[model samples]
Target: MNRIGIPLRVGLVLVSLIWLVPYAWMVVTSVKTLPEIVAAPTAPLPAGLELGAYREVFESMPVARYFWNTTLVALGIAALQIALAVPAGYALAKLEFKGRALAFGLVLATLLVPAQVRFVPVFTLLADVGLTNTLSALILPFGVSALGTFLVRQALLSLPDSILEAARIDGASELRIVYSILPPLLVPTLVSLFLFSFVFHWNDYFWPLVMTTDDSVRTLPLGVALLREQGTGVRWHIVMAGNVLLSAPVLALFALAQKQLLNAVAASTS
Candidate 1:
């Protein structure tokens, strides 16, 4: 056991370091002087702390505006997904309505369909409605999350029927039961869903790239991508700085929600 454990731990540490290499390089490169970056592009450590790249990133673009736009879109998508998922999940899991199986089947079927396949139709629809290049275009297409519904339904399945029965006996309405009773018990699962939706939408690039033509509704990822085009040539330092900023919020969110995310996975799998 000791011998096996040591090798396993060592292998895990090696894998972790490999995964962190790019992120570590991004951070290191972001703080390096332009001269140093130009001279030694692949150096793991910066010789001196320089924030000019960060300053340049801010000055060259509307990073704050991009950040705000991305935040709004991500929050909107996550909120809509959860709000719709809870009821849809509950009904699919607990209710005995007609065509429940077919409804759930439809939900599952959507998961098999790649999102890329729907982009043209969705983009055309948004274009027809003049919602293209709007934040609504980003959020609206993602509002109905089949994955969120599936996770919530699975979580609800693991819950006992007695809870709902008791709520009904107390004369609680279905709406009250869904909003009041189930949510509290579903905290871990909901948090997991919120984080999932939030992170995906926050980091999303292709959808925004397809939808937006200019900076008016451009997201952080798009803004970061634009960094390479700012200067006379590809400014690696400035681009890395933008990437660090792009990744910070997601890293913080995961750090905060790691426990709840684990619990949600455990609960669903159990």
Candidate 2:
């Protein structure tokens, strides 16, 4: 068993290294000079460290503006998702209402329907509302997430019914119970929802691309795509540098929240 375990562990380590190699290359390439990057495309370390690519990335585009746009859109979407999803989740999990199950079933059905299938209709509606070229176009459409609603609902369902019954006996309104009693228990779910919304909006590319024609409205992903388009034959190092800058915040956020995210999942299951 020990001999088998040793070889299995070694194989897993090799697979993990292979998976991380591309990301490692991106980091190394970002700091490498153009000539050196071309010379050693897969070098584990920077052949000669240089800040020129990073400088070029900042100089060539409004990277800061792109970052700000993405941040604002992501935050707005997360807030709206939480606002809409939490109450909806609570109602579905606790309240006895007509068509409640039907409504939830419809929401579940929506998960089966790909967003791409509705893209044209959504775009047309936004166009009609005169929000096609604005950040609202990106943020509003994704404000109500089916997955968030489902996750929050499941979390709520797992709570002891006695607590809710006690709240009702004490004459607490549904809204009051939600705010005072249930909300505290839902911190983990809320955090997970926030993280999900943040990442989704941050990394969103297609909807933003379709909605915003102006350079000023572009998010980081769209900005990166535009950079790639314009920077042909200029070496990929500058683009890689821009990618690093764009992704650094997301990576940091995930690293910080990963522990909390895992703990939340474990707590929910327990």
Candidate 3:
């Protein structure tokens, strides 16, 4: 047991360090002077920290506006996904009705369908409705998350039905039970879902790129890409700085919600 444990611990540590390498490089490069970056592009350490790249990144683009747009879109998507996922998940997991298996199977089937496959039709629909180049276009298309619904359903399945029955017996309506009674029990799962949705949308580049033709409603990823394309050639330091800006919120969110995320993993696995 000791031998196995020791090797496992070492492997985990090594994997963790490997995972951190890109983030470390991003941080290091973001603060490197242009001269230093040009001279030693592969240097693991910066001779001196230069914060000019961040300032240049801000000067080069409307980062604040993009940040605002991303925040609104990401939060909106997460909230909407939770609102849709919870009840659908509950119905699928708890309530037995006609075609429930078929409905659930459809949700599973959606998991196999890539977003790219549906983008053209969705884009056309949004275009017909005159919703193109707007935040609505970004938020509406992602209103239902198949993966989120599946996760919530799986999480609900692990929970006993006695809780739902008890609530119903006490005159709690289904809506009330879902919103109030079960939320506390499902905080971990919901938080996990929220974080996943937020992060996924926050870093989303493809949807926005394909949807919006103007920068006025663009998000941070687009802003970063525009920053990369600024000047005659790519500016590594400024681009890395944009990446740093993009990554900061996610890191902060993980730090704040890590406990719940861990609980979600444990609950899901158990």
Candidate 4:
């Protein structure tokens, strides 16, 4: 068993390295001079490492504006999603009502429908409301999340019913029970949902691209796409640098929350 495990571990390590190769290459290429990048496109190491590409990227585009736009929009969407999803999830999990099953089924059915299929209608609605060319256009459409509602519902369902019943017996109103009892127990679920919402809104590009024509309202992903388009004849080093910069904060967020996310999953399952 030990001998077989040794080979299995070695193979897994090799596969992991293969998956990380592209990201490693992007970082190395971002620091390499144009000539060096062209000279050895497949080289594992950067030649004459420098920060010139990053400097060029910042100089050539409104990176700060893009960062701010992404941050504000993503944070707003995350806060709104959590606020809506938590109460709805708690109701679905705990409150008894006629048609509860039907309501939940309908919600689950929506998960089968791709958001792309609704894009045209959503765009038309935003345009009709005269929200086109504004940040509100980007933020409003994503204000509520069905996926968050479902995930939190599942997490809440996994909690002990006796605890909720005891709280109710102690003269706790439904709202108070949720605030005092459920909220503390559901921290793991909340953290997981927050991370999901943050990442989704942070990386969203298609809706932002379609809704806003103004450069001031563009997010990081759209900004990176614009950089590639406008930097014609320039080396791709700048583009890579922009991508690296755009991805850094998200990477940091995931790294910081990874432990909480895992614990949340474990707690829900337990």
Q: TM-score: which candidate is best?
A: 1
Tell me the whole-model lDDT of each prediction, alpha carbons only. Answer: 0.89, 0.84, 0.89, 0.82
Q: Residues 1-270, candidate 4, lDDT per residue (tens digit)?
A: 556687799999999999888788779889988888788877778866799999988887788998999989999988888878878888898789999999888877877767678778988987898888888888887777777788779888888889888888998988787666776887867787777778878999888888888888888899887777884585778888988998888888878888875664564443
Order the candidates by TM-score, highest first.
1, 2, 4, 3
**Cα lDDT, model 2, residue 43:** 73
Order candidates by lDDT, high to low: 1, 3, 2, 4
lDDT of 1 by residue, 1-270 (tens): 456687799999999999999899999999998889778888878998899999999998898899999999999999999889999999999999899999999998998877699999999998998999899999988889888899889889989999899999999999998888889988877888887778888999999999999787999999999888875988898899999999998888878888865665565454
Find the 10 residues in a row with the least total lDDT in model 3. Answer: 261-270
lDDT of 4 at 152: 79
Lowest-scoring 10 consecutive residues by lDDT in candidate 1?
A: 261-270
Which regions of candidate 4 deviate over 4 angstroms? 1-6, 160-173, 260-270
Stronger candidate by TM-score (1 vs 4) = 1
TM-score attained by model 3:
0.86
Q: Residues 1-270, candidate 2: write the lDDT tens digits.
A: 456687799999999999887777778888999778778777778866798989987887888899999999999999998888888999999889999999999877887877688889999999998998898988998878888888889999988889989889999988887667776889878888788778878988888988899878888898877767784575788888888887888889879888865654564443
Query: What TM-score, over all chains together, does every model reach?
Result: 0.91, 0.88, 0.86, 0.87
User: In model 1, which residue pairs have backbone atoms overlapping below 3 Å?
Assistant: none
Model 2 poorest 10 in a row by lDDT? 261-270
Measured on C-alpha atoms, candidate 4 has an lDDT of: 0.82
**Worst 10-residue stretch by lDDT in candidate 4?**
261-270
